[model samples]
Target chain A: MNEKMSSRTLRTLPREKAFYFFTSIGNYTGESATSLKEFTDKISEVNVKSLEFHLYRGDFEKWTAETLEDQKLAREIENLRNQNYSGTALKEQLYNILSKYYEKIISKF
Target chain B: MKFKDNTVALDATDLRILNALQENARQTYTAIGKSLGIAHSTVYDRIKRMERHGIIKEYTAVIDAQKAGAKNIIAIMTIFTDPKESDKVAEKLCEAPQILEVYTSLSEELLIIAKVVAENQESLHEFIASSVAPLPGVLRIRTSMITKKFKETRFSIANNPKQLAFIKEKSNK
Candidate 1:
């Protein structure tokens, strides 16, 4: 079924010498290591693990609720805002939630 | 002119010229000078200095593929190969015109993300089969097509104050 869908989609695309922008993340070892370095530097400054930081300044809950359209996940993030979980622990919990959410959504695809 | 750090320095005027040219590279230096309230010769000299320093690489047109009778298919492909053979494989991949950009991921699993262009799906598939799949060390290949693009731009320089300061500082050094 997936093959059929892919074939149909491929056929529908227009003919052109398409320009592509490539980005590789995770386990990338190449000449363009600077790209990864810059990415990590930026991500490190974001403090992704701080639920309080996200609640006050970042859009973590709003993004989860609106963009991801996972109100339950957003609520869970909001709940974490008050919890005493350390930064690393909060990040782990968020990662697990996102992983599960992606698994459920991607299975539909 | 030599900056404090012996690097080429671009003053505010140079940056203004760059921003104008980035919007339309074909703009005459006289026009750019007029807009920025500088002499045309100064504009020309600044641009030449920037080019010499490798700041401005090339000026090229951005053509619409569909309008030009070509199909753009963006693909992210993971090429699994022995770690030792990865560089050789990447070098070979660069020889293919269809492949645009290649990057290796930093995961435990060696993965390659490739951007490819083709006239059609058949050619795209053929390129993968003949050029990529048969590579001696290739263990697996997984490709996902990009269906749409939301934003694309060539200009890395922004008119923001912080970015300008950074550029100035770097150039001065």
Candidate 2:
């Protein structure tokens, strides 16, 4: 369990795989989160519009699963996405999920 | 009328929390609750509730634009559009990234007040002539370039003490 959570869930990825934040198609927020912890921190600071944009498009699950290689976190994100939480509600829930996962990992160390 | 259904009626605690956040978003939960005589856990719970309700959005960091080399020339434009197409025009303007904010005028004429930012005068002119003036409903556009900014703020939560709901903190705060 610790091995599953430690590697990609918290390990910093290369610049190529960083989750680049965007408010719209061409509008980048200058944030490229390399790890789950960084992504969680960015989620709280990046505009909620960007959060809503990514949530509606299911981009969060895609990145967390494919890039981070953490299906557990990805599935949780997918479930949250399916619930149709929009705007700030979506942001609040996503932050809670990521923070909980982060704390769980930190406790082991 | 529209607010009747989904209004998040803020209680005294919620109001105090919002006021604290407005002052300094970087403050810890303990710092926020210190002035209001509430626990940090209570502060956390209240803030999360506000977020869930979509009332409290993301916390922002203020930047010194000039120091960061992100100095933008501010322009406030008043656009008069065809009455029938006013709403559509406003919506279209919102999709334009150059436009910072879009507000519909309540006066007699179908007017749109939009705050625009550009690198310089040429870009501003290009934006107005090419992107704005050529829009479907745009009849005419009047642009005023802001030379200096005196004050800009989103809210003054402390100013309103008349609300009976906030009577609890009238003494110290």
Candidate 3:
């Protein structure tokens, strides 16, 4: 994947496809991020445990790639996961990547 | 960066930043920078990197349980599980939202100590009788309802040995 996503890929996704946060299996954190910016923002302040759980389970990359049709971000998250990042460390890296994509999304409108 | 050991390449500045955040997490990055005589952006970057390294966990409000009305009734429950099913039982306990914290300690048998909360005595009893008691491999459960609390302490993130280890070894190969 290149550094930038296509215009269509930057658009907001449907509400039902929003990424939900969970602390553990069957434990919801009462937060869902519907767009790139929202994902970036929630990823920063959401429970670290929730972030770690989803990351290890490959939820983030799958949601981004399949629902959002963002192969670029999906691969980025996959790279981070393969690197063995966990907990808050993974959150920080994921936040940085999402922030960059968020800037691209807002600048188009 | 890490050296020969897996230890982080943290410096005095990193230590000072941690001290500032540990003292007061709500303080702004600029405030921390001013106190440390460094640029606020540097402080921001350092903190972000440390978080990526899993050195800093999260900022949370430490509330008085009884006063907050959030988790008023706290109980300490101990479960003795069959040695073979220790991890499985502990993982099952963790799946429940009521269990706040879980720790394992060595005793005559494998002991799982869990801190849980409920709204009232009836709910607490139901949670135990229905949710806890039915778990497979659980030998017995001992629960103690706290009448009062004397002292409590914050859960420091520094003690977490689960910090993200660098994949340097894998990368080298």
Which candidate gets the maximum DockQ versus the true structure?
A: 1
DockQ of predictions, in order shown: 0.02, 0.01, 0.01
Score residue A78 of candidate 2 by CA lDDT.
Answer: 90
What is the per-residue lDDT of model 1 for residues A1-109, given as tens digits with 9 covering 90 to 100? 2544323222322111111111211111211101212222332333443333445432456544543344666687677665655566656665565555445544555
Expressed as tens digits, the lDDT of each residue in A48-72 for candidate 3 is 8988888887888988898788887
Model 1 per-residue lDDT tens digits across residues B80-139: 777877888888888888788988775887766688877655566557754676565665
Q: Over all chains combined, what TM-score does candidate 1 have?
A: 0.52
Clashing pairs in 3: A89-B52
**Which rank order by lDDT, best down to worst?**
2, 3, 1
Evaluated on chain B only, what is the TM-score of candidate 3? 0.79
Ordered by TM-score, highest first, the candidates read 2, 1, 3
The number of the candidate with the highest lDDT is 2
Tens-digit lDDT track of model 2 for B1-173: 11668877877788778877888888999988787788999999989988988888788887778799897898888888889999998998999998999999968787999999998876786576546665667766767889988988785567676653464545246
Task: At residue B128, give the lDDT of candidate 2.
Answer: 68
TM-scores, in order shown?
A: 0.52, 0.57, 0.51
Candidate 2, residue B129: the lDDT equals 52
Who wins the TM-score comparison?
A: 2
Model 1 residue runs over 4 Å out of place are A1-109, B1-11, B159-161, B164-173
